[model samples]
Target: MGIPKWMTGKILCKTGADLVNATDPELVKFIGEIYYGLFRGGKIRQCGLGGRRSKFTIFPHMVKKLNTGLHVMIIIFLCVAIFFSLVSFGFCILNAIKVPYRAINGPAGACLWNFLAGGFVVLAVTSFMAAVKLHQLTERIANFRENIFRFVILEERFEDCFWICVASATAHAVNLLLIAISGIHFPKIKTKTEEVNVTAEDIMY
Candidate 1:
């Protein structure tokens, strides 16, 4: 999420009549091409000004400026989610290619892994939302390393990358439904049996 070009235009127009005959070359150039922050995946890129392309990652680069603990939590949850998703994928391939132990390769196992992945994805999303909304993440990122110009957020929205995470969560949920539809039985239900009691006298006889 980042500031839009229209927002920059609005801000420049708000600077009064001087904008019409701005003598400062820098100010004129800035009006022509304003700076905007764009967040994509793990990195933030500076765009829309003087062909200046500056990029940096969330880790190490901007960690000091962000809620480090919350950021780390988000990363950890995402990593765990990816691991579980991979495990589920491998289990699916195994189920298709060869017979495997029920504990590891059945619909139940798939459901378990999918559930775990979905849970972590939810955690990651929630944590990131908190970091962004409650903590002013985009504003913080936009202001990072700026010595002169200050960037104020005019509008912010989740970009495609963020929605992709949402889509992944949705996919995991759909996988759970598909696994259930595949006729999954609880382990206890599958192993249930009637028990017979034999008395000592019957045994002796």
Candidate 2:
């Protein structure tokens, strides 16, 4: 999902520099405050000294500054998660309306899709966190397209949008648990048995 336009306060990471420590006046001008929100497409606000403020979207504006590969991976995983969640919902509706095939009867189909969705959600969150921590995402975003001044990360934290994904993952887990608690056993693998000739003589022996 994309970031909401109204969610300006849902900052994912915040970065600031010590203006007093800057010896260069031009550098001090660029050193104020910056924060990035959850989605890359969301609005990122950069405030400089003397109340000079500029706003830009993170996707097209800061794409060059981010770890493009990891960022793309996170997006792909999120899309997949959404797809699987919808598939699970469809399965739930199917179960309520009609009798399904043996392979997907009861909670089995829903559970499978939920598991996949939860897995992808976990992957997305983990990859995003890795990109943020290992690649210094906030600092990169804060300093995007700037040649004169660089911003160091002063403070950073996961915000509401990140937690929303976490909550979705938790909901998937709870759904699976509820399915189990309802006494519906997950489908088990069945092995094929070879037919053998039975003789009365063997039994007598």
Candidate 3:
């Protein structure tokens, strides 16, 4: 059968349409230049775009909408994790005390995990609470600044508390990661085989 001219024309037209939207390497290079320009000239900010902002805002909102049972389980897990972390920190301190006496022997990974993770959890939580308190104190002072006769207003205290909280939280997150990695080896059980010269005779006896 002879090929139709109309069909061939339609195929060529579709190929041309696809080429219109094809990516250009030259255009990509131009985009790279624009990005560098924005950075060097300070013409653009690193703020979240619409899609990025939506993703960033979605997780907490989704968590807030979780069912009561799931919420309760989350709370329970959080409480237990916090409690165990504190205990681990205590164990770390005990291990530290015994370190100088050379009384403790074995793989220090577990002790390290307990100490670091627990201590970080405690430090982060305490520092965050302290930051909250400092913020409240700052607000109270600001509200009563005119009414009070001799008030020493320290706004810097809140900043310091916030930084401390940030550092502690970062440390706590690292500790959690370390603990998770170390936990893989924590519950290991080793089996040993014993050899005897007269194993059959001993079994008969």
Encode model 2's per-residue lDDT on 1-205: one tens digit a residue.
5653212222222233343443445444433455455454322333343544556665765776678788888889999999999989988888889887755656777788989999999999998888878887766666666565455555567767788999999999999998778775669999999999989998999
TM-score for predicted model 1 compared with the true structure: 0.64
TM-score of each: 0.64, 0.71, 0.26
Error in Å for residue 71 of model 2: 0.4
In TM-score terms, which candidate is top?
2
Model 1's alpha-carbon lDDT is 0.65
Q: How are the candidates ranked when ordered by TM-score, highest leading?
A: 2, 1, 3
lDDT by residue (1-205, candidate 1, tens digit) is: 2322111211122132243444544443432222322222221322224434445555567788888899788778888999999999999999889886797688789889999999998998888888878998766766667675555555566655557778999999999998777685656646668898999998999
Clashing pairs in 3: none
Give per-residue CA lDDT, model 3, range 62-148, as digits (tens).
233323243344334335545655665665566556663432322254445445554544554453344325433222222221242
- Scored against the true structure, residue 59 in model 2 reaches a CA lDDT of 72
Q: Each candidate: how many clashes?
A: 0, 0, 0
Provide the lowest-lDDT 10-residue window in model 1.
Answer: 5-14
Model 3 TM-score, all chains together: 0.26
Candidate topping lDDT? 2
- Return whichever of 1 and 3 wins on TM-score: 1
Better of 2 and 3 by lDDT: 2
